[model samples]
Target: MKTFKSASAFKPQRQTVVTIGTFDGVHLGHRKIINRLNQVAKTKDLDSVLLTFFPHPRMVLQQNQDLKLINTIDERIRFLSDTGLNYLVIEPFTIEFSRLKAEDYIKQYLVDQLNVAVVIVGYDHRFGRNRTANIEDLKAFAKTYHFEVEEISKQDIDDVAVSSTKIRKAITEGQIDLANTYLSKPFVLTGKVVKGRQLGKSLGYPTANLYIEENYKIIPKEGVYVVCAEIDSKPYFGMMNIGHNPTIAKDNRKSVETYFFDFEGNLYGKTLEIQLLKRIRDERKFDSLVALKAAMQKDKAFSINYIKTLQ
Candidate 1:
């Protein structure tokens, strides 16, 4: 897939069939729309172009510093790369760009810049300053731009919207399976291993302290999760904890720690990308270290059995 940082930089040699959205998570709903876009482009003998924005519009419009996303920009690119798209335009969305008049947006960006032969959009997609233009307006503008406009199925449009909300809700509620069902893939979290108190080691389950740098990347609710990661190019099954070590210390800060079953290594400073498969239980305090260790052993046994079933 070809990637362009800005619309100005995207110079398509062939006429384009285009669609635009943030396309967060690249979940099942998004895949359907992308499949339609690719199909239209293939039948019409044009290149498929996905014009997605960075710094998602909501983060800009609402000034929502606390808003989180299911996928980071890099993760989005990685997801879209597998969809057989021809062009991926990463438009830099800013306040000034948002202020562009509806007509100018179509003329300058879609029509003149992209040489778009067709535009595939959602039934309720809105654009222009303060989202003044709707799907109808896009169809109306198509006549002047000499391009065809296709609306994604109403069911698909609703599914796309709902899936995003549902996935986030599921993750926040520690419903990994539900979220994965909608996403069509396991929920993933990536981080670097850092030094920790080594409390798990004392319990015979050495844990790697994960430090996630992306503040906007959504972290699932505090719980123990059945997960897998690649270490030394080999898949490793593990149980992860995302919470404060209440049994170890009353004032312990929250941590993402994973104990890989049957694995022994020094993972300090190594990056790990963990794919969460299921939530085992919520994090809680135990009466003593002995009690906590016993509970952890049970969790490990359950996680190991679950991993075996997948194999």
Candidate 2:
């Protein structure tokens, strides 16, 4: 998919079938709408364009600092690229932009700019200043704008039985299986490998520490998880611990550390994408290093066996 950071950069030669939204996680629900956009675009020989917003609306409108997101904007782009979308336009969400009237938004951005042949949106979708315009308003404008409007009913969306909220909840609750089912992909964390206390190496389970820069990225609950880390396009099986080292540290400072099986290298400063496969156990405080090591061995065996089953 061709990506444009600004809507001005997206100038489709052919008339476009478009859908607009934040598309937070690009979860199954979002994919349903994207699928319709692509299908309609293909059937009508029009371009498929997905106009999404960045610095999520809530982050701007509500000043929601506590808002945790399922995927970063970059991750959302990668996820949407696999859906056969022709164009992905990321509009910068700003106070001034949000003030556009309903008609202006439909006309300027959708009609005049995109030359939209058709617009696919949810029945309950709201747009324009203060989100005053509903799907009804969109349909009314479609008649004036000379574009067809395709409304995806609640049923069509609810059939997926997934929402970004539910996915975030599942991940926060350590329900990796459920979250993955909803996402149609594993919950992932991409981060740069950083130096740690080297405690894992002493335990004969040397680990690569991960430090995420995106503060809004939703982190899974504190636990040991079965995961796969991709580095330089290669996949490595691993188990990750997300919590304070209760046994090793006097202060309970949280950290994300993963021990990749049969792997040895200097990964410091390199980025790795870790995909959570399943949760093995909650983070627990062991009485001694020996107890922790013993438990780590068991977790490794379980993870390795699980990886075998997947293969």
Q: Among these predicted structures, which one has the highest lDDT?
A: 1
Residues 208-271, model 2: lDDT tens digits: 9999999889999999999997766778999999999888877777889999887777899998
All candidates: CA RMSD (Å): 1.4, 1.3
Each candidate structure's TM-score, on Cα atoms with residue i matched to residue i, is 0.96, 0.96
lDDT of each model, Cα atoms only? Answer: 0.91, 0.89
Task: Give me the displacement of residue 194 in model 2, in angstroms.
Answer: 1.3
Q: In candidate 1, what are the lDDT values of residues 1-311, reduced to their tens digit?
A: 98999999998898999999989889999999999999999999999999999888888888787888999888788889999999999989999999999999999999888999999998888999889999999989999779999988788888999999999999999999999999999989888999988878878889999998888899999999999999999999999999998888547688999999878879998988899998999999999888898898899899989988999
lDDT score, candidate 1 = 0.91
Which segments of candidate 2 are over 4 A away from where they belong? 159-162
Q: List the residue pairs that clash in candidate 1.
A: none
Residue pairs of candidate 2 with colliding backbone atoms: none
